[model samples]
Target: MARIEKFEDLKVWQLSREICRDIWHLFEMTPLGRDFELRNQMNRSSGSIMDNISEGFERNGTREFIQFLSISKGSCGELRSQLYRALDRKHISQEQFDMIVVKTDSESKLIGSFMSYLNSANYKGSKFTKPTSTSNHADAQNPEPETQNPEL
Candidate 1:
């Protein structure tokens, strides 16, 4: 596996971003954009998929990252549900609905696989790594005081 220094480097995040962009364009070009409430809600939910991934990766811990990935996956499902509404309301064509739904499904799978990999991997996360130190700061800055003799 390649080292992911940033969320953008992750395939799942990249794909999620693409899906979000597509949804944005669809809303802008289609009559769906006219529905203020649904348009805004769809935009927010689609954006959240990648946003959660980015947030989790920046958290610097495997556990937190996993939690964020789970949220992102849930967003994918939510977005799919909204797509159904769009289809039913004639905001989008059946073809468009199918394409976006497939993309969202793929994103959810990718995130799930990544989470599984993280769980079984030996490397916890960057935050869990202990920092190397040649000397103890407390010991170097302050010396221990001498104790009084009990016999005295």
Candidate 2:
């Protein structure tokens, strides 16, 4: 099994967390937190983006891991949507909206690229998976064969 020793090494995940931290601080300035509904929804969705990536990396199963990463991408989208809602309701300034939107979009693309990278490699995450699987053409209509458990 391959180990993901540093979360920072996962650039996409790290950036997502940074974006969330900035938003969390911004939220503190507003009475939005008192709203309960929007506040917790926004917070939890942003958090899920970071948490899912870490959980995916730790799982060390490329297929399932990529599934989780894809989920993270969706969560990033969800967070961005909520930010727009917050802005429309006057919870955030234009500058904050722009900052958060740009970063979130960047994170979204990075997640897509990461997914493409994995797809090109056939969902093989590490040296361990490489010997038994090749992800290169898996994204094509005719998918590559699934990786068997290397243990046997």
Candidate 3:
């Protein structure tokens, strides 16, 4: 498997970003914009999905990354709930709600799968790894003898 150098390379994060963009579009085009409370909550939850993923990746630890990914997954669920509320309130069409919900669900599942893989993997993380150089170890083990001074 190729190394993931950044969170942006993550498929889950990419999908979360797309979902956030879709939610923003709904705000611009739908009555949901005027409903400030729901709109703000929705915005925050959607943003959290991607933000947490990036934050976790930057932490450079497998445990911390998994924690943040779990949070991001929860945010996905929150967004889905908010979508249903928006649908009930007539703030969004059924089609819009369905589409966004599907995306959020998929994002949640992807996060879960990633967390499972991390849990099962042997590699802890980059931060936990130590540098290994045979030459450095040998130098450390045997130092050069000091020269004697004749006129002390």
Candidate 4:
């Protein structure tokens, strides 16, 4: 709500960071963590949640930030799914699964709340205005216009 200066200022991101740490700790204890395929997938999904939130905040306007928040939320879901896999595979106890699930759900609710705040404050059409220049390069293709080619 207040002008966020650092990524830590965001409660959702802080929660995500904590979740990542818990996931890493779980990875160290679970047998699935020893398997390269499962380990890599779980770690990546866990890290993505925090990474996306920070990336979104660094993207400058509220619109870009909200989009990034959505991505972060998706990553959280992915992380949760992987956690479930670990549980179903008998790599973790039900207690462990429940603990992580609670954290993931809390993080999701926080992200949603942040998105709502941003939407109410910046979704009035005044916030999506693009810089009145060629700053669209990120989405634009090559500068040279393509000519027709009929010969195959």
Clashing pairs in 4: none
Report lDDT (Cα) of residue 9, candidate 2.
Answer: 61
Residue 101 in candidate 2, Cα distance off native in Å? 0.6
Rank by TM-score, descending?
Answer: 3, 1, 4, 2
Q: For residues 53-80, what per-residue lDDT tens digits would candidate 4 score against the true structure?
A: 8887666567887898898888888888
Error of 3 at 106 (Å): 0.5
Off by over 4 Å in 1: 134-152
lDDT of 2 by residue, 1-152 (tens): 32234455677878988988987887788766666788889999899989988888766666767898899999989999998888898888889889989988998888888777666665454423434244654434233333232110
TM-scores, in order shown? Answer: 0.85, 0.77, 0.86, 0.77
Each prediction's RMSD to truth? 13.8, 9.2, 13.7, 12.8
30-103: candidate 1 lDDT, tens digit per residue: 99999999999999999999999999988877799899999999999999999999999999999999999999
The C-alpha stretches of model 3 lying farther than 4 A from their native spots are: 134-152
Per-candidate clashes, comma-separated: 0, 3, 0, 0
Cα error of candidate 2 at position 2, Å: 15
Deviation in Å, model 1, residue 38 alpha carbon: 0.7
Q: Which ten residues in a row have the lowest lDDT in candidate 4?
A: 143-152
Clash-forming residue pairs, model 3? none
lDDT of 1: 0.83
Total backbone clashes of candidate 3, pairs 3 or more residues apart or in separate chains: 0
